[model samples]
Target: MTTNNNTLLCWHSKRAGVEVLVEAIKCLKNRRVLINRAIVLVQTDTDSSLYLNHEFGDIGLRFITASLENPANHNEIYQRLETSVLPELKDVANLHINVSPGTPAMHAVWLILHARGHFPSGTKLWSSQFNPDTKRTSISSVDFNVNTYLAEISAISNSEGSYALYGVDPKSAARREALATLKEFAQVPKAPLLVLGERGTGKTRLIESVVGIVKQKKVVTLACGGLDSQVVDSMLFGHVKGAFTGAETQRSGLLREAEGKVLFLDEIQDLPTSVQRKLVRVLQDNHHYYRSVGSDKEETSDFELVCASNKTIKELATTLDADFFDRISMLTITIPPLRICREDLLDDWQKIWGEVNVNPSLPKHAPTSRQLNKLLESSSLAGNLRDLKKLAFITCAYMNSYSPTEALSKAICSLQAFDDIEENEGTKFSFGDLSNTTKDELDKLFKYELARAAKRQFGTWSNAGKNLQVDQKTLQKYMKNDS
Candidate 1:
């Protein structure tokens, strides 16, 4: 049978496989039309072969088969597609390659083609049947829809409002106060806003809730961490066709996508220096222009920018260019960490536990008076609300396997294990466990807990110091002094 290497085949027999293939095809078709003819690469299995023959045969689609009994034979099939097939389709504009669910040979073929850059530039690769129930799909490169997935997950996991903010009372005062503020904020004339907090402090949840409150606005979220300068620039500012490498078509960036809406940026501190400068320009002038990939024309767009970060603005300013910091307005709201509001643990626990899928018969165990006192007194929460939720989940799992008393005992044992490990490794002493602390010395206690938690999580002073939101040199100084 004749095959085209530039034409990729997606092979799947079941519903889940087909769904993934459809989604993948949708993503590709939205970008460009494939005309060189494509095939669904299927195995020699009965179901797949029959499906291909009966269901897709009339469509004039091609089917390439490789032996499933011996995965090693896939190399031969790959050679045929690469050497014999792709050469024939060289004249086809926008030659592309894709593969469906099949043997290891299919994946190998893709990897070889990708390494050799044989596929068309800007080609989006996908894996089929990643999670059928969740309707989850994986794309090789980041796309606008990736933010949509993050927003969807955040919405689903948090819809039940199971976790309470740190500083709020669950039922009466705190809940009422927070909700009142949120409602008021929603009613205000829409403008650029900023949410500031330490890592894992539920800033995203608060921002999402606010977005929901502002019903008329579209929310486009972006994480600025670990992205390349060029990608970040293109993502925030629409790029024209041929603007850069792999830019096959003109595309609107998030700023344009979120016009007359909210552009929520997470980890704003990680935005590159050049992008930061551009953003500053946008904020100050309320208008900015972006050059298309290969076009000479520049497009101007406007939008509301909402930025969130774990780093303090002062600290971020030190790392970023002055012009960027100058453009960011001083209106900021800080979300307190979980340890500050130990009184709301029960409400938070109940809220989160209700949303989790668990055995219905599992008994709900509220913390005992003594346990509450101990938890309130302890300060080992390294990751704020995120850590607390994880602890709650672990506690719930343990409760399923044992009685409340037993589960509490297990938790105590784990906390003690943390202590034992620190002692064995000659880590610094914890101030909370120390005696005779005056009011003036209480701040030192908080610092000790922060440092200890950072060290435990990172296993080294330097990394732990980063988590503690301090410099490595300062952490070394603290370690050397051994207060």
Candidate 2:
């Protein structure tokens, strides 16, 4: 078949099958191709077996194999195609298309195509759409337009899917508003973002979701907890070959790799004073210097910075270098804890449990509204979403053997045991049985618990203030009045 070099027929693996086929058709339409040859690239001989043995096996197309199981051969295959086969193609006008689904192989094909300079500048790429039904299946193409494809991409990018590893229910209107605000900031133009939340409220998942949106962008995630100044410096800035005792070969630092993408530093509060100073410089100037063994070269890299911490920047501002604190504080969003968003448990539970295989035949013992309310009311989720999800899964298993009421009663009794620990651990103030306390006393107790909860959640006055739905100064007054 005659085809233009402008239209490349790139077929990704048929794992996501018809969804990818539909996407490929959409891309073909956008490229304005009248007729094109399809090149189906299979990751394995087994994968190729499926298509070769399929009913529609007579489609006029070439098949290429690019499996990663054997690295040496894959490299040879890549070179041969890049240097030989691709150059020898009869129709350079045939648009290079990638119809791979699911596997990293699809992305690899796209990168290879880009490296070969086959497509014109600003060529939009479409990813294979996910099929929730059928296990390990294939698909056929559907008619799609460019605008429709773009809309699908946008929707997929924003919506929650199986990729959301961990999540919590947003119980209150205020908490939901806070989540919306965080999502908004994630979509904002490349700028430093600070995520302020409690330890277990799924701050990491929020960041991962943002990373998913900017899939093309490089992501460098750093966990700053328990690292001292020198370790922090070595990891972030990198060291020269022989720069330190363990240094062997010259390594590219995360900052360099994160260029034009995201550098997520988790537990930002743990960053040492000296390294914080260097981070500030990088954020402001978008460049840094690295000294290697027997060589000194200044490297320049630009990246969007996203920071997360259980502590508030304000509390750590005095302890951290002032310049670093000021630079990152410009953009901050607080993530609310599970206790505040108790109402969201059922929905979150359904989304989570639906994806994983959890003994489908076990029994239909889903939590009732009354049961959910009782679960929320009786227990304090000290670990927030992380704790809640774990508890839910446990409750699911626990309920299979026992009745819902019996399972729930056992769970509540176990949780109440922790109250004894809380009492003996310290005189930590709690909201405590507001049912019996007077309104005035309850108000006083609520303020006390809120402050304490904030302190536990964020580890700093300023961040806890943000979670409390108040400004820093107002939080200070509340703290003082309680004292």
Candidate 3:
């Protein structure tokens, strides 16, 4: 039999201990089967996961926490697998399933999914057995023809909505259209792509979904914000040994590493002008060849480019070079902010809160449905998804001690309190605005707004402090605690 490196998917057996999983992986390794990664479904606590990671983390062992109510029930197991396990298979290649560690019902669902055309077309199934008397572990293929079972069992319908797999609302027309555009763009290869959205709009997540749809094997990413110009150039294009003052060894940069895969550049608007000029040349070339910073030799990398920015198109045009902007705009995806898509905020809040409050035994730390609706109706979420998530975190932390409605209201008030002040409002203040606010909180807000307005008007901390007759350090302190 011929075998190659592939991703292994299996369940961790509680009865037999993770030793069974370790030995099974060892058996495959001995057979010269290069299992590059494993997705182990674990039902127990984090200790077992830690043990597995300690053992085979070099080979990329990953765990999925699947807390099943009835492990033996087919329906329950199938639903759990569909929701959690299937989403992770987006970028998987040459998938191999180990069927030895799970229950008979669990094993049956694996085969059912195979017969129902759920797994990738060429997925292989393997089983391992441990001999008690001989104390030896053996492996073999579970090579039953799924086609034979297909005649007896009806195929499952593809009833899952396109956005349903991504935890997005199917009822949202704007989101549905954006997803459709992404799906169409994923099929076209080697075109530069641009993703535009406000902060916390999940631009990276949307791109990952596209990569999964195309089944790309590798993804390399870098956030271009706040990086020095020379450092960003060397990091993207690589450098030879002794290329700079601190260089002791040669470096293979992100472009070379992302060969034949996806390269994601986040905060592209912050990339320096010099690097943008070089990158524009690389994109315009037919072969995409460029020289390293110090090397005379020219090299080539044919990787797909995906760039994201939190700025609008108009803002990006002002920040980025015109040629660079035109090249990356070959394909574009824009994520709508949460304020316009308010209907989606409910689902987003529930998901974010559920993630924050992971312990099921803890009392529910959520507002009543009516109270939540009223809170959303009154709040202005300028930070979009970020603000909604922050509200969830605040509610989860304070709801146990305070009334849920009060917790949510306080969270909204805190978020809405920090808006840019108007010129006329600087002269007049309202006591109504200070009703629920403490004196200390009001003082902090006052300092924060004053410092920001001064900085904006004067364009420097020293000038602002001199003009306001305040110490520079005190202005900086106020800005630090404004968070």
Candidate 4:
């Protein structure tokens, strides 16, 4: 593959100047690697690229200005390469990335990008080393394996500190194993990855962290739940000006917006079968492309597809189109629910507490460790991370106005009462099984508790109403009845 290398891509080092690039070119030439074009990343504030361009202009030199004074800014560097560099090199089949120049951070970014499969299949990463004994520089391809690298670093990332980076506390063996699986899956950049987890099991958070590493841009997300066939099709494949009745001007769609990034389809099992068939073709192979709703010309978008569902693969198979399900099931990750990893409850509670305390919109109040521990032990966390966070928010609200002891007391009682209502939510309540008066009391109690929980979850009554699917007046009525 190196024999067909027509592009020499590298970053210009300030200290080494153009010597590193020149040495790499010489070594490539010696190795019979044809360099028809040289793409160099130079500092935006420097004229060094002009001089280097003057010297290498005959070799089709192209300069990409990078504001990389602080080479440690990996996000900026990765974005620049994704938006500017990679697009330019898409046509270069056998590209070579010279890692001889730039800072240590820059070199790491290249390896990460390559290991994560951001580079094309035939791309080579070359490293040049100077041999003092021979008074010459030799070039060699870095033999880095993505799976092997992930294995070597698994030990380091298995700790609580690393998991905390993703706003999760994987304290149990099951959670640690799940995280390891996720890290390995992240190495396969383009393969469609499916995440299976119950509600409030942190599936979205896990995807965010994994996608953050593989792709440095924000994920483009579309919730497929409750969306009809036409809506899903127009959203994913976009539409021309007159494609649909109310498409307005033109819609580029989530798939187009997700080019060079990750597209997370939440609750993917809910996607209509008609749209699922269309996606099978878009996700099949290297030549995958999609046609817009009203256009015949095929359009291409290069993106990583990540799907998530609360249902298991078996459940998904029953509902999804066979081919579409098979295509997206290329890689799967299952996250154990909080019930299985109950040991993480306290840690998860603390993390939520810390976030609530720091939130600028919430009244800042610190609770004693003893109070927090007492509250955690007394409250029910069976609802998973969501319930634990809600408990923390409610406790924080109490602490803002009440004594620490009183806040703990109120929080425990509230959670226990809420848990009772939730536990009995689906049971039959005929007059023989339960009196009308008792049923009315439970209904009223459940409504008040739900209203209060919503208020705590969302800072304002308006937001609470919108999220709870109730009108502001209804929520106000519930609050008034409670008072």
Worst 10 residues of 3 by lDDT: 151-160
Residue 17 deviation, candidate 1, in Å? 62
Clashes of each: 13, 23, 0, 0
Q: Give the residue spans of candidate 1 off by over 4 A.
A: 1-190, 287-295, 363-369, 415-483
Pitting candidate 2 against candidate 3, the one with the higher lDDT is 3
Least lDDT summed over 10 consecutive residues: which range in candidate 2?
142-151
Model 4 Cα shift for residue 293 (angstroms): 0.6
Instruction: Please estimate how well model 3 matches the true structure, expressed as its whole-model Cα lDDT.
Output: 0.71
Q: Give the runs in model 2 whose Cα sits over 4 Å from its true position.
A: 1-171, 211-218, 287-295, 352-366, 377-380, 396-400, 428-483
lDDT of each: 0.57, 0.58, 0.71, 0.72
User: How should the candidates be ordered by TM-score, best one leading?
Assistant: 2, 3, 4, 1
Q: Among all windows of ten consecutive residues in candidate 4, which has the lowest summed lDDT?
A: 151-160
- Writing each residue's lDDT as its tens digit, candidate 1 over 23-96 gives 55555544454334455555555545554433422234555553344544666766555544543433333444
| TM-score for each model | 0.51, 0.54, 0.54, 0.53
Tens-digit lDDT track for model 2 on 6-29? 433454445444345545555455
On residues 113-228, what C-alpha lDDT tens digit does candidate 4 reach at each position? Answer: 77645554567899988888998888998998664333223322332244322222255788888888887787776788899988888788667765555455568889999999
**What ranges in model 4 sit over 4 Å off?**
1-169, 359-382, 428-483
**What digit string (tens of lDDT, one per residue) describes model 3 on residues 343-456?**
566656754554555546544334546656755543445566666667777766666677777777776555545433433355333335677898887887787778766764
lDDT of residue 452 for candidate 1: 53
